[model samples]
Target: MSLFKKKKDELNYLIFEVTRKCNLDCQFCYNHWKRDNDPKAEPVKEGYTFALKTLKTVFKQANPKHVTFTGGEPLLAERVNELILFCRMKGATVSVITNGNTGSTTEFSQLIKVGVQLFELPLHSYDQAVHDRMTGVLGSWKKSKDRMVGLMKFGAYVVPVIVITKQNFSQVGETLELLNNLGFQRVMLNRYNLGGAVLASPEKVLPSKEELNEAFKQANEIAEKRRLQLSSNVCTPHCVVDPNRYRNILFSNCSTEIRQRPLTLTVGGDLRFCNHSPDVMGNIFRETIQTILEKSSEKYSVVARPDFCAGCMRYEKCRGGCRAAAQQTGGSFNDVDPLVNTIKENEETEIA
Candidate 1:
């Protein structure tokens, strides 16, 4: 089977968690991004060599429609240029999600020279003090914003991801206004997933459903007015826009179109199925791309949940989703069932 998938397994989004180490600790971060427990050892530039080999395998396996570079902070990872090169090596449009604190604008520019098409960063709060307070670091707000400017200066497409929580929800308008003024092409508004220890206080992290719907409506309105894009993810909602033009949205609960994705390729080249699971799908270095898919597809059959899709009537679409967050956060399959069912009921009522 040569093990390299031709197109059947082609994915719409390939999210790679290149590393677990992060510089600053955001209070509402869903994963324990702050606590990188790699009893294995500390991070070093040496990691990139391993990264290059693994990426070659990923490019062949997924045949991604779009590939996203992500991490505790991807810019902190070694050989980002090499990784971008590999992703571009594929036909996939390349993008990255980052915290924007790294001090390598030149390196970022170098990646831009290639086919890295887009950059999404944290645009948490309008005021530096407020942003810094949420992130628990001084000057992070200033540094991150400056880095966003750096990305735009390089002529790369940019989108800022702001997680909505108690502290920052009230200031969403201010944040969007600033991004619009700065001429960013888009902003993705994220709802905090009360999963990791970072968001132990559900009270602070999970905004009320009414609040989220209202905010999404207003943000969409503002984004439309400014001609900017806003998006959310992780089982929140869905809104398909003009084939080319985009809008602010939640990335959560997307159809199976985006589920069943491995969150990370380990240092050893194994595909860890989920962020919290960290279990491997065999080492890509040893197996052919086709074999990798066959194995992962089988794994999904055993673990993926199709019946209780949280926000999808099309359970067959995304399967059970990446259940790592539910595992770690103490939610169950039932928790998501209501989400999908409730939305469906409301949708049906509206139609009726």
Candidate 2:
């Protein structure tokens, strides 16, 4: 027999962190998007050449069908276009998630020409002031808007992201209308994850359960009217916001689909447990994808339904809410997600 064994699960998607350097300072940003843009700033110890070599091996071994280039802003990475082209050469369809602050419209067109099939950007609100304030930068909304329009002109499938927070939750419908008017057929609405900058004071940014439900309600109504396909970034607990209530929304819950999971690779070649968690499970440079999966099998196995979720019909779909959220708030992956369990517990106390 061969030294390496073929794993049961094949990697379908790969999330590649091109760089952590970013320009904008959005309030609800989950990751620490570093502003290391100065010429005087210290250089990265590990060069891109080494990263490229590791990525080549990963692509050859994993052969993921789709790859996403994300970062503080992927455009800031050295020779980013070349990076996208390399992935294209490896037979993976490329998608770039950017802030649209670094590159020009012409650069975006060149990216699409070089086989970047998708572009995902943030458009927080219809109002210019609201968006600029959310990003903590003036004139950013216009820049993002221009890039979105320019990408559409070049026949690129652009998915505008609307992060639902207390600040922009009420304007979800207005934002959806704006995206539809901009000629986008699809949009992604993200629930703010309780991590990074917001971890200190989640209450300041996280939307209440009522706000979340209403936001989804308006989003569904507008999507149905505008014929827009809806998708989400994080999965809300079923108890917090019932998934069945939304008609046009596509909810994402990796916990429910543990066997076929998409992998996230940080810039340093470390494989993160998930998009939300900062925990590193393995490094792509050192281990094959199959080895990482086998060694981390116990971690993945411990993420099933909680005891209270024994007979719940939504267990299969929700898998007791986001595993990262539960681990962050309740201190265990098996613990019930505080986003739901806290509210449910309070209601029971009142009944008693």
Candidate 3:
């Protein structure tokens, strides 16, 4: 079977960019690429009635296994609980990614009761000052930390995402220790993808391979010690830091190699390429979910593998590195992943 060909039934994950309004101005927000230059400009909130109506249409056509509600902050959207209830009614597990400062304890509990099974919260570091600085907000650390504990108390599954960057890269171990102490069982160690606002100052934001290697080393050790689950979605080339070396850490395969792709339905009713990339593949209002996935697969195939990746034993596993990262940093999907300096050989077999 052709790699890019996916059955319509294979669509499993869908994201609803519920709103563009956010409370904080993070240094490395992927969505900043589309944000207004004037910070004073009012953020846009999606029409709640229109969103729910469109989502109902989508669910009628195809019920996805997982549906995510995200935005500058999902909680900012009025009547978001109704949307959660709708997804749950459609038999889709619901998740929401938030900055953790928007809603009260009562509001959060209401969301959990309405069927928000999971919440992805961002916690840059254990140090309060560092966390607040990264978020460009004062005292946000306390709110986020308190809310994470509060959500878990409400019986909701919460994953604290640590976006690895030069600023907080050295504090990985400290952050992991804090999460472990807080009783977080699962954590995501994410890489700062080169996109959005960071494109203007990529050097200051993107971590060096050496910085990442050290961070991973700390993460691997702490994960085993604390018995915490550490996973990453960013495509780090195997040559940069082999996943096998860190037995405790889980590095996900690039989606371009997989049959099922995570599709994001933006607030404007358009489907994005993925969560990180700003590229739009199709619109939810105009195209069916199956049609969007099929067209996206064609675009995925166009992303070329790096020349050095040819016949490498791990080629199938890594897919020559993150196509989204390549497109953003190198200006083309065919460009080599910025993290890769040289091809590292596999000990068991030579490159063909």
Specify the highest-lDDT model's number.
3
Identify the runs in model 2 with alpha carbons over 4 angstroms from their true place.
1-10, 32-47, 255-259, 301-303, 307-311, 341-352
Q: Which is the winner by TM-score between candidate 2 and candidate 3?
A: 2
My TM-score estimates for the predictions, one after another, are 0.74, 0.88, 0.87
What is the total number of backbone clashes in candidate 2? Answer: 0
Candidate 3's residue-wise lDDT over 182-290, tens digit each? 9897999987766666666777877777788788999999989889899987877887778988889999866663235567776566776677655667776788766
Residue 309 lDDT, candidate 3, scale 0-100: 80
lDDT of 2 by residue, 197-314 (tens): 6666778788888888889999999988888899886877787888789978988876544435556887677776666555567887788777887788678654567776788888
lDDT per residue (tens digit) for residues 290-322 in model 1: 566566665444335544544555444344443
Clashing pairs in 3: none
Question: How many angstroms is residue 250 displaced in model 2 relative to the true structure, after the best TM-score fit?
Answer: 2.2
Q: Give me the runs in candidate 1 sitting further than 4 Å from their true place.
A: 1-12, 32-46, 59-65, 90-92, 237-252, 257-263, 273-282, 285-323, 331-352
Candidate 3's C-alpha runs over 4 A off are: 1-10, 35-45, 257-259, 341-352
Q: RMSD per prediction, one decimal?
A: 6.5, 4.3, 6.1
